[model samples]
Target chain A: MKVTGAVKTGQRPRGIETSKDGKFVYVAVGDDDTIEIIDAATLQVAGKLPSGEDPEQFAIDSGDKYLYVANENSALLTIIDLATRQKVGQVAVGIEPEGVAISPDARIVVCTSETTSMAHFIDVEGRKVVGNLLLGARPRSAAFKADGSELWVTSEVGGGLSIVDPAARKTKQVVKFAIPGLRGEEIQPVGINLTHDGKLGFVHLGPANRVAVVDGISHEVLKYLLVGQRVWHGAFTPDEKYLLVANGASNDISVIDVAAQKVIKSIQVGEMPWGIAIAPTRDR
Target chain B: MRLGIVVLCVAVGWCGVSFGEPSQQLKIGYMWMKPSKIRVSLLDVPADNDGLAGAQLAIDDNATTGQFLNLGFDLVDREVSKGEDPTEAVKELADEGVGMIVTSLDAERLLAVASAAMAHGQLILNAVAIDERLRAEDCRGNVIHVAPSRTMLSDGLTQYLTWKNWKRWLLVVGSHDNDKLFADALRRSAAKFGAKIVDEREFKDTGGARRTDSGIVEVQRQMPLLTQGAPEHDVVVAADESEVFAGYLPFRTFVPRPVVGSAGLVPGTWNAAFDQWGAVQLQNRFVIKFHRPMSTLDMQVWTAVRMVGEASVRTGSADVAKLVDYIKSPEFSVAAFKGQKLTLRDWDMQLRQPILLFDGRNTVSVSPQHGYLHQYSSLDTLGTDRPSSKCKLN
Candidate 1:
């Protein structure tokens, strides 16, 4: 209902992820080329870790041992050791790497490249790209299923959602979106989020100004919930009651009631709000 | 005929694979007709590979996506020097099994290549020719235009001018075929947008040296005289695509009015200062790769290549027939950092996109302006609509 607080991180902050314990929020400051650590309790920048050029999106390992950042401009993945908060190693992926996702088992990490239009799979132990699966044009974000059996990647320009099989390293199904009156080009799928129970999935259609709710099992678009202009990213509240989306052009975050599947309120944020990360309450 | 045979032989040698290879490779040929010399101010010289560089970058992008799908993409760049027949370049690319070719040439040469390539059932993407007739009476089914037409550009500028309440325009046209065509587009735009052309004049290109030791003094003296004696007008619209005098009229006009069209505050597909809708990332990537800021030509060629890339990926094949069919189909669209996906117009095959009005420093506005709307799309507001199209593509 209200913006708890807002903090200025750096120019063009793109991707955000909260720590497992919800103590720190990692914000990818793209132009700054660094991951700024925001202390959840104080809502202040605690520390920063150097990343590759134009880090856009990142995901931490299930064990919370390492953090993987997708360097969009450099086309490389920078791996940071969470304990020391230092760069441990780097893996060459593809051109314009924008999305990073770690599997539930923490054995594999998927990096989606926008220009490359491929999901490069990295072996966590070896820290090397083991394989790649071609995707549609301008793949923006990737999300893993609850069981990690499948990975859903949103292609912004392709205007579709590619559901990939992790074991086979191939796309099993592609779910395309179309509105009756809107042209196909207007429905650009960008940010994606899957429910913990894997029953529902939310895909942000960038210029379409709607978030598509798909039935996870059938992969059918259940509803097109209207949001704001050029929505980019989404994060779930700690209690799983609400899904908050950062609408980049509108400069606000649209709050969706999870049970009702409708936008309840739009919380105003800073200029061009791109990414969001919700911290778990201490009571949890 | 001999050049065509030699080109065919070279093409057959390069692509040794049979027609039905399991892993299909899509080879796109970029054919450029290089002008022997261009007249421009000392600071405005163009890069040697202006359009080709953008194609190269898009090639890299295509290959990145193609590698996973077993669809390999290759770019064969051929430059036709001045005085050489551009048709030979198109024939050579066609013989080499290139079903798609991106070209950056003037209208006349582009028409020759387009007609020649169409015979072989090949598709051509016109990346930098702004001639409106190409999409109108001279339209060919084989050619798809990525560049914005003169009508589109003029209408974009006129829309912004009308929104700003600058109603009266003094039109100055250069004495060249292309210049006159552009002037016609401006005239049409002024009439459609409820603006008045108070006066019109032609600046004769008196053939002489474009550059001299004391050229500045001469240009400064002649520019004011060239623009003098016009009726009261709010702005001066110069159609000098020939680059003969429009650049000199910006600050040197007789009445101190803002100049537009071919120079100052020109309407284009892309600009270096345009950063909206995540274009800054594209600009940064282009600069990092090429070591220079992206230009309008670069953006046009990039979009052309990206169109081919999108079609190939969506169809999951490198077959030219399939790619062409997909592109012409209602489903095809490509995103070029323009806040929307650009689609091909079924009637003329011109890519429908928003035009950026740049003032040489920053983006002033984008057209398909706020108030201008169409039943189908706002993009239709800029250029020749379906009702006005004389193009009977066959």
Candidate 2:
């Protein structure tokens, strides 16, 4: 319901993720090309780890042993060894890699390139690309279902969400967004997240200023929740009771109550707040 | 690491299976006139690849989307020297099956190429020429103008000035033909927007070098004399598109009035400092790719090529007629980081976009200024409307 605290990081901070144990939060500082480590308990930046050039988005593996970062300018995935806080290796993907995601089982990593329009599949252990699935233009972010059966990637310019079958390594369905009065170009899908039960999905329509709620099974858009301007990314709280979306233009985060499916509060953040990551409460 | 190796092996095994044949190729042509002896300001010189660089970036962007739809896009760039005919280049590109050509030529040269390629049914996107006649009496059926016309620029400036309550203007125009044309547009815009041009003057070219070691001292002395004795006006409107003396009027004006037009707060397609409506991402990408800030000329060409790519993807075909039809349809719109979709006017084929009022450093405002509304789109207020269009596209 409120912004408990805020921590200053390097310029253009984008992707954020909490460690598996929920003790630390990793934020990708894009312009600085480093991931700032925050002590979740204190909400203070405690350390920094080297990432690839212009790291925009990143994902932590299931075991939290490694972090995969999508470097927008470098076109490579920088794999960081979390324990040692060092980059172990890098895998060449596509041009302007902006979105990175890991499977629920932590076996595969998906990196979506904005300029190349390709979703490259990387083997976690081999640290090399296994295969690639061509996606829509300007793909921004990706999320895996809780069960790991499907992967959803949001394409900003293409204005559609591509649902891929992880096993088949191919796109199965593309759910395009079109509002009654809004043009197709305005409905840019950027960040996507699915509920832990895989029953509900939320897609941040960049510039459209709305988050689309879709039924995970039928892929039907159930509702369009209006939010602040230029909404870029979203995250579910540890309790899964609310969704917090970062609006770049509005410089605030819209908190959506899960049960009521409406915006409950607008939490003011730093200038151009892009990505969001939620940490579990201390008791959890 | 062991699981990664096993998965990689299996993926390599699956990669051997082939898919369907590659998509059809969509070839586009970029035709432009080589840099000519145009008046250049010592302080603000033009980039050599101003229009071409933008076209190339858009081609790269289009190819990214094309790759996913089983469509391939190729750009054939042709730059002809001064006094060289561009018709040959257009014919050659048409012969090579290029259905769309983005051009950065003057009004006459563009007309020549358009006429030459008309038989081939090629669609020509005008990216540079801002001559109002091109969108008026000289409009062609196959020519879709991506650059804003002189009228549009003037209208944009007038709207902002009117909104600011600066209702009176001192209009100064250069002797060049393009300058006169722009001045005419300003006059029309003033009449339509309820502003009065208190005084109008023409500054003849008088034939002299623009940039010299000692030109600034002379300019500082002469600018005030040239602007002196004008009636009471809120702003000085300069129509010096030729870059002759307008840049000198900013700080050297007699009455300390703000200048607007080709200098001061100018209306343009894009500005490097513009970061609104998610334009920072685009500006960053352009800077990364070109290692330079994008100019207005580059943005015009980029929009043209992207329109072609959008049409190709939407129609699901590379056929020339189909692409042209789609672009002319109301459903066709291209997002050029302008916070809205830009579409072509059905009557004149001129692109409808909000003009950014930019000073050298930052965006002052975007015009169609807040209250001006049209029945169709607010953008229509910036240029010729359908009822008043002189274009008779056949």
Candidate 3:
């Protein structure tokens, strides 16, 4: 079955978030600062709710009942009720919020802004920016460990993944990628992935077209993998035996055998598959 | 409890995985279409090194401002044999310190090659594959394409068709299966371009011989009857990829309508008769390479390789990641075959390139006229759009 459905809000919709039960997909339409909801089964667009100003990215709260969208131009985070797809509250963040991540408490949100080069730690309950810590240049994507200990943020301009400790509101480690080969410049990461075991972390190195697999604890580059032209996202199969990589440049998706660390087969799909989220979480 | 603690520790501290610092190598590898020994037809007909011999070409032409300083313009080539494992080859290239790879293969091989590249932080460059699926559903971070997508090419053809007001077509297909597939693509293109297929005809493969006994008389007798009265049509599009009777079409048509498809205005990456702006230089270089003319395959590969050289020079850093970024960004454009600079699409990794609408003798008009509108660019005007698109890259 195709995981297909899109909700066009005001304009320029970029990112999406799915409810835990897989019933709805919340689309972040940046220009209008609106979150549109769609029914996953019927591919029907349902309702539209207010996001903050110029929302860029959003994340799901731990309970899966609240959605937090990071609004860039307005420097705020809009919290919404999952069931109603309605805005419940908004918190002031640092300037130019780009990525959002919900804390383990389900009552706090962490946002990264490009202009300020810092992450604003917010208390969800009070709708306030509780803390601010500087990061790198143009932080774009963010992810959290399964257990929610540390948050990973990718700095597109800085060409690295910045690890932020949520509890302490501090920067942990910065993992950078290689500069471009033929096209010069640093490789800016767009997406982040972690093995089911959570021992391995992979960063989607854009234009670099590789995945930086790092050892989470030691912060070492375990391997740099060439996936495809503009490699974007990857997801593990239910058994965790295969890792499927979306090769943006070539119009193919590679099925990687995890144990062998080799590509078994490449299935051709529709044009340019971008972001991915694997359902029914599996274990190692 | 101890085992759980160890697992937690491993997960918590897994970030310490590095192969030391990177060396300055503009590392690039090749992922060819055919896995075994193969041949690619060139528009320059038998050019060497894809027809760059006479051109003032430099492997390090892209090198600029003291970058790729460790190893300038490192291009490693590996022929992809059908049975040979592409991933293993990618790993081998990585071992040789190649940071990026370029391929002229289908979407299937592109992704396989990409996985291998990812295993070693190597990037893959898709130079020839034009399947739209790769751009939409299979877009990869480590892999970026440098070739015009099939959609782009089709769209190019459709625009000219639309402009020509070739409102009606008699789509004729050869006996070969691939011919039918090409016809299918034409059908899609026709619908997209607002053209109508009055009727579809299939020419069967009889034998090597065309019933030669009294055949000339019979051909004169039947040729007119076969075509003259085909409903209502403005063009007879033949998909005779197998070198069938479509070649005898144009004048032989009963109705005397224009013939297109493979026999008429063909859409392709490059054509030998083309001598646009930089084409003459490219053609000359290719001729010098093989003592003959350039072929479509030769020209495409040559263009793909040259693109790497150009991006390297422009980016001023030969780092594999940086080079890929430059190519992926809208900022990086290459002056290629269709008399314009092309870039990658934001929605799809498909290269937004100009398609040469050729008639085998001379160049026709390039599809993306200046005024075409698209969110990305007029180049996107070639293939399926978001509305008619079936691809959902999730």
lDDT of each: 0.85, 0.83, 0.64
How would you encode candidate 1's per-residue C-alpha lDDT over A43-159 as one tens digit per residue?
899999878788888998755679999887776899999889989888877777888998888888899987677888888887777678778767889999978878999988788
The number of the candidate with the highest DockQ is: 1
TM-score of chain A of each: 0.96, 0.96, 0.84
Each candidate's TM vs. the true structure? 0.90, 0.86, 0.48
- After superposing candidate 3 on the true structure, give the runs of residues whose Cα lies further than 4 Å from its correct spot: A1-284, B1-25, B33-71, B138-141, B175-177, B205-229, B241-245, B369-371, B386-394
The candidate 1 chain B region of ten consecutive residues with least summed lDDT is B13-22
Error of 3 at B219 (Å): 8.4
Provide the TM-score, chain A, model 1.
0.96
Interface RMSD, Å, model 3: 18.3
Residue-by-residue lDDT tens digits, candidate 3, A95-120: 45677877655766777765444567
Of candidate 3 chain A, the 10-residue stretch with the lowest lDDT total is A177-186
True contacts kept of 3: 0.00
Give the Cα RMSD of candidate 2: 4.6
Please say which candidate is ahead in DockQ: 1 or 2: 1
**Recovered fraction of real interface contacts per model:** 0.37, 0.10, 0.00
